[model samples]
Target: MPSTRRRPPRQRHPELERDFVRTPALGYEDVDGSGLVRCLAHGFPSPLVRWHFHDEYELHLITHTSGRAFVGDWIGPFEPGHLVLCGPRLPHNWISFDVPEAGAPERDLVILFNHDPIARAAEQIPEMREVLQLLDRARHGIEFFDMAEAARMHWEAVRGARGMRRFAAFCDLLCDLSECTDYRLLSAVQMQGVQAEAQVDQINEVVNRIMARVNEPLSLAGVAAELGMSESRFSRFFRRATGNSFTEFVSRVRINSACHLLMQTDCFIADICFQVGFSNLANFNRRFLEIKGMTPSEFRRQAESRFGAG
Candidate 1:
């Protein structure tokens, strides 16, 4: 497989790049009407499909086609009924491999909204506070399973309504997403709720250390000793807070870092293996394939499509 030798463009404005004649009706005016939410729809093979980020929380649904999905540091497959919520500035893109020569007429349904309005309101509205955790999880990107049909209905309702009705529909969607349990957090590391502030601080420090010195050996026993805890206690504490065993979390961090290098640099895969702290070529390849579902070279070749056709 070929590798990308440079970085992809980081931002794109589809509305300005293409005429709306081919896309589904857009709800851009709703941003002005409701002063918060904006809905968008686009077809496959359109300029809208690119690696990019913006300052809005986006709920994206795929109504047709199956292909690869790139969200922050996560790479995976997505098919019809795929739904994901990406937080502000989290880079993402979807490339449909099943598109016909004529291209798909309507493949994506999206809703974009700002964070400040709802966050500020939650400060005063007790009921509105429930969605805050959901929003926080969006920072890492959230893929909701079994939510496609309901998500489609909600998107249509919000798209067709105006004024308070539009806001109400949007809120109703957020409520269901907040209560959703069939979802996975994609990108970086997964963090569960930590009850104590001190514990949060401790875990944060440990994560920062791991990220900073990823090339170094970090053992659970060593970390436990540093924290003045026994091996089993530290293991339980770390797992409870991060949803991964200490060793697994370290491996994930290394793999995530390797993904970035594969996308941005032309370094040899063997060199990258050791650069990310893996002891040997065979182990690195195994771990990367296990986590990303592709070999390092295969990922690089596929990732180049994220920039879209120039």
Candidate 2:
């Protein structure tokens, strides 16, 4: 087989560029009954806490505990007082270190709102203009290294206040964050754009189901049938909503999970292949090579070299 392990040059075909753009999985949050901005607190290990994205911009504050934060392809340490802004369609998740004694406590305070609402407000109010640039930069995910106190105050205010007071506080919070200088972009690669919001909840539900049973023998036709959709209709809908065909998306997710297993466990390659739902070793190796650029053994060696053998 030809070597598929190399990263292609920047100047490839236009079609290849689109193929390289991997859209993050959609996350659907019900905020219709709430105000323009939705403020909520979540505990660690909750169902809401997962590797997913949405159509709204997220202002996330790490209130308690310390652990790893995954944004796009970047993985790094995060602690209490950590603050970040993830633009629409940026896949992110924070996995906290388990403290058996303390248990899983409420760890994050988050505010989510749409891009257009803030942009339109900026057009009408010149003082809000500064936040426009900040929002643009958030496409790669922004981590604020300073302004912990300001973030904490605004997070609490937005959660507690109602009516116009909450709206004003929310705007002020954006103004404060927009002026901050101590921040860095997290993701190396730019993400594919957002999809239709109306379809997001349904797509998220289907994606969540796929994630839950990734290690089992999953079939596209079966899932389509379960949703009471024809196979062709479901395939087209999934591609339009997620920017990837069902098979390609599932393989990517499976390979990503396999990478974690390779780094964290001592399981044999064949065992991992089976664990990730591949029927045979050869098929698993082939798919893994296409998505991950390296064979299973090579990936393990490289991962262990950088992170140390677990």
Candidate 3:
């Protein structure tokens, strides 16, 4: 007998293409009556995914396919069973690159929940502080390298349960993730002032400037003028807020951009240097070596060996 079940229609949401501004917050509804947590499993050919953020902590499992995973300012490879925990308002997306003859199957197992309820629970119960601490680490986003199957089982349990049973399963999943020691932080550094709107705006302004005009020379004085602050005040404020000085932050961002170019293009080393904001090849080489521990040519070689060129 042929199966007659029809798949649900795909849902679409706004996504950030290159702009790192605030991603749209997707509101989840309790259509089936599970209010505190929302679990969803879906498939797509080439899903309408994008770099986005929300106020909910997301435990995302890549159940199928492979591609690049973008979280915060990090971009790396991902495959099936890739499990990551994203803290509230952390920008993230997973883009699949597989092209199967049968089309890509269901790819994501996602669970989203708010931290306030958990925080309230933790305050009432002393032991739940560990979970709160886990949430803090999630601010940088966490990619679990071990216990993939266990996390999947917990996700399934939560997806299948209802009422208090669902909540209990969710709690168990968080406990398991919190206890797991084999994980890596995805972002090079976590974004600061997640809850402070003005601080986040300043960071975004700087980030947007760097990413958009990576080829142009960046100066603290110019940035300060653009933001209407004195250079000294801006320097102090940016360092305190983001844990990186203005110049250091710009160079880091430029280097990261150069890394992507190295892996994705066949451009000449010196041209790549000028294209990523360095004034001269020597300075570019020096900065790249200091930050990446390799010269531009060497970095390109490694990237080619790892990803097999664009």
Q: Which candidate is the best by lDDT?
A: 1
Off by over 4 Å in 2: 1-33, 189-310
Off by over 4 Å in 1: 1-27
> Model 1 misses residue 287 by how many Å?
1.8
Worst 10 residues of 2 by lDDT: 11-20
Q: Write the per-residue lDDT of candidate 1 for residues 210-270, one digit (tens) a residue.
A: 9998989899999899989999999999999999999999999999999888876777788
Ranking by lDDT: 1, 3, 2
Task: Write down the lDDT that model 3 would get.
Answer: 0.74
Q: Candidate 1 vs candidate 3: which has greater lDDT?
A: 1
Model 1: worst 10 consecutive residues (lDDT sum): 13-22
Residues 1-310, model 2: lDDT tens digits: 8887645322211011111122222122244444788776767656565566777788888878887676654566788889999888876778777434655567878888888877888789898788887887798789998777789899888877777898988888988888888888775422233457767777877888877998997889999999889999999888877678998888877776776677557777888888887888999999888775678898766543222112
Q: Better model by TM-score, 1 or 2?
A: 1
Error of 1 at 194 (Å): 0.8
Give Cα-based local distance difference scores for all models.
0.85, 0.73, 0.74
What's each prediction's clash count? 0, 0, 0
In candidate 3, the residue pairs with backbone N, CA or C atoms under 3 Å apart (3 or more residues apart, or in different chains) clash, namely: none
